[model samples]
Target chain A: MTPEPSPSAPTAAPPVPSTRPAATLQRRLFLVGSLLVAGLALSVVAFGDLGEDLVYFWDPSQMAAAGEDAVGATIRLGGVVKAGTVQWQPDANSLKFIVTDGKVEVPVEATGAPPQMFREGIGVVVEGTLTKSGVFTSDRLMVKHSNEYKAPEGEMSAEERKTLYTTVEEL
Target chain B: MNEVAEPVATGVITGGWSYIWAAYGVTWAALLLFLGRALLLSRAPDPEPE
Candidate 1:
C-alpha cells in the first residue's frame, strides 16, 4: 500500500537556546594543570626531604667547586685510607685516618669495628657531615672488597670496642 | 633494645637492614619526585577526535 509520505520526524534532543554560551573544557584542563604544578613545586621546596639532589658527594677536587652548599649536607667521599695517619682513642674501636686521592686528603673517623674490607690503601666510603674543624666526623664506615669475599674484622676490633665501652661505663 | 637496658643482650640491630631500608625509601621518593617534575613540565598534543 502506498501510504502518503510521512513528514520528517522530530529529534528528541533538548532545545538549545540561541544565546546560550558554550563551555570551554580546555580552560578547565589548563587551570587544573597549572594549579597541580604550583602545588608540587611548593611541596618540593618546603619538604626538601624529597629533593636529595642537595645531598653532596665529592672528592677534594669537586668539593672546591661545591663550597658552602655542602656545609651541613651528608656527603660521601671515597679514597684510600692513609697509612701512618690512623689514630685511635687508645682503643682500636674508634679509628681516625685520612683518605687521599693522591692529591688532597680527607679526614675520616669511624667509631666501631672496621669492616672486613677495611685496610690501609683500600677504598672506603665514609658517611657523615663536615665539622667546623673541616674534618669529616663519620658515624658509619663501609669498605670495598674484591672477588666477592668479605674479610670481616676479627676479634681485634671487637676486643677494642669491649674495652673502650667498659672504660666508658666505669668512668 | 639495649644491652644495658635489658641488662644482658647479644645482638639487636646487628645487620645493616635499616640502612638498606632508608636508602630504598630515599631512592624511590626521589625518583618519583623527579618523574613528577618531568611530567609537569612536559608538553604534549591531544589526540584527534573520533
Candidate 2:
C-alpha cells in the first residue's frame, strides 16, 4: 500500500535525461569530416606543383604529336633503339642512334659512353632537349631490360661470350 | 668434368618484406587503438548534473 504524503514534506520535480553523449558524438563526427576535407584540399595543392619540377617520360609518337611545344623542354624520350642506326665513334666520344616507336623515328645524339646493356633493338630512355633540327640531344641515356631470370641450357658458345662483352664500336 | 652447373637465381627482391610488414603492423595497431577508444566512449557513463 502507498504511504500518504506528510503535510510538512516538500515536493520536487523529476530529473531530466542528459543529452551529452549524443552531442559529443555529433561534434566528433563534424571534426573528422572537416579534417578530411582539409586534407584533400592540401593534397590537391601539393600535387599541383608536381608538374613543374618532375620530368615526364614520353614515347616517340607522343613527342611527334607534341610538335614545337616539345622543343627546348627537357624530357625523357622512351623508345627502342632502331637496328642498323647505331653509330659510335670511339675517338670522338660521340654516340648517335635512332629511337623509334614503329610509327615515328627520332634521331638522338648523345655524348660520352652509354650503358653496358645498350644495344640495337633494346628499349632506352634518353633524357635531354629536342633541337629545332629535330635531333634529340641527350646527356643521359638509360637502358631498359626485363627482370626475368632464366637458366642457361648449356655452356655459352665462344661467339656468344665475345658478343656479350663487345662494345658499340664492334656492333 | 663436362657436367653443366646449376644457374644461380638473380634479381629477386627479398629485402623489402620487413618494411612491408612493418607498415602493415603500424596501420593495424593504429586502427585497433581508434576502435578501442570508440568502444570505450560508447560505453562511458553519463555525467551527473550539478
Candidate 3:
C-alpha cells in the first residue's frame, strides 16, 4: 500500500513526468550528425573538379580590383566582338578583337582554330587569362545560338564586320 | 551565377553513361541514408516507467 501523506506534504505535489527520452535524444543527435557528415563528404567530392588554383571569370571592372593577382589567374570572359575592330593575323593563327559587355571593352587574342559557330555580332564566352599586353589569350571559345532553331551562317571577318555587321538576319 | 540569360551547359547528361551512373549513385546513397534516419526516429523507444 502507498504510504500515507506526511503532514509536511499537506501541500501535495503532483506526480511529475520525464520531459525527454534518452534514446530519442541520442537518435536525433545521430541523425543530425549523419547529415553534417554527409554534407562534408559531398563538399569534398564536389571540389574535386576545382583545382587548387581557384580561378574564376571576371568582367573588365573586376579585373582592376584583383590587381597583379589577376595575372596567371584563369578566367572566362563573355561578351560580343566589337564591330569594325577585329584583326586576324592569319599567318600566325591569332585573332584579336574587342570584347565588350555594353559597358567596357577588353581586348582578346585567341590563337587556334575557332569553334564552328565563332563569328562577329554573336555572343561568346572565352576561357583564358589576361596577358602583359593587356589582351586575353583564350584557351576555348563558344558561340551563343538563338533558341529560335535555325541553321547557322558562316564566318565573319574584316570585310564582313564592315558590311555584314548591319544585316543581323540571314538572307 | 554568370549571366542568367545564357546557360553554361545544357542540363542533359550528355557526357556518357559513366557520369550518369556516378550522379545516380550519389543520389541513391543520400536517399537511403535519409530513409534510414527517418525509420530510426519513428522507432524511438518509449520512456521507461518511473
Candidate 4:
C-alpha cells in the first residue's frame, strides 16, 4: 500500500467561491453599467449649462418686438450695417452705428475700433446687452461673410478710401 | 490685440470650411468607434467554465 500520507503534508488550496468566472463577469457588467450611468449624468449637466449660455440670434425686428422684456439680457443681434449711420469718435474711443434689417433699426454703441471687415451694407453679428435706453451696448462684434467668395460690389468713396489708407499708413 | 484709433484695412476672412468639415468628421468618427466597441463587446465569447 502507498505510504500513508503524512499528517502534516500540504494540499492544494481550495478554489475561492467568490472568484469564479461568473462572479468576475457580474462585476464587469456592474462596472460598465455604473460608468454608463455616470456618463449620462455628466452629459445631462453639461447640456443644461450649455442651454444657459446659448444666446439666440435675433434680428432688429424681433428685438423691437421683445420691448422692455429684452433689456439687460445678452443677445446676438444680426443685421446689415445701415449706411451713413456710422459715427466714429477717435477722441472718445467710441464707435456708434445703426443696424437695420429693413423692418426695424437698432442703435449700437461700441468702445473699440470696428472689425477690419466691418463696412456699410455688410452683415454683422453683435454680442452684447440691450440696455433699457433701447441701445445695444456691444462688447464683441463679428463681420458675417458669405460662403461664396465673390468680389464686393462697388468701390469705396474717395474720402473713405483716403481715410482707410491713412489709417493703414499710421499702423 | 491693440485697439486701433481708426478702422484698419484687411483682407476678407475665408477658407474655414476645412475646420467645419473636421469638426463634423471627428464627431461621426468617435460615434462610430463607440458603436463598434459596443457591438464587439456584446459578441465576445463567454468565459470557459472553471
Tell me each candidate's TM-score. 0.40, 0.49, 0.42, 0.47
Per-prediction backbone clash count: 1, 0, 0, 0
lDDT of 4 at A142: 84
Clashing pairs in 3: none
- Give the candidates in order of lDDT, highest first: 4, 2, 3, 1
Indicate whether candidate 1 or candidate 2 has the larger lDDT. 2
Every candidate's lDDT? 0.67, 0.81, 0.69, 0.81
Each predicted complex: what DockQ? Answer: 0.04, 0.04, 0.05, 0.10
Candidate 3 on A32-148: residue-level lDDT in tens? 999999998999878776654554455666675566776677888777877656665557877677788778788888877565555566677788888876778886876666687
**Model 4 whole-model lDDT (C-alpha atoms):** 0.81
- Per-residue alpha-carbon lDDT of model 3 for B4-50, expressed as tens digits? 22222332224477878889999999999999999999899854433
What lDDT does candidate 3 reach at residue A13? Answer: 61
Tell me, by DockQ, which candidate is best.
4
lDDT of 2 by residue, A1-171 (tens): 644334333354323234478877888999999999999999987877876556468999999999999999999999998876787766777788899999999999998878766777888999999999999999999888879666455688767767776865476
Q: lDDT: which candidate is best?
A: 4
TM-score of predicted chain B versus true chain B for each candidate: 0.51, 0.64, 0.55, 0.62
lDDT of 3 at A145: 66
Q: How would you class the docking of model 4?
A: incorrect
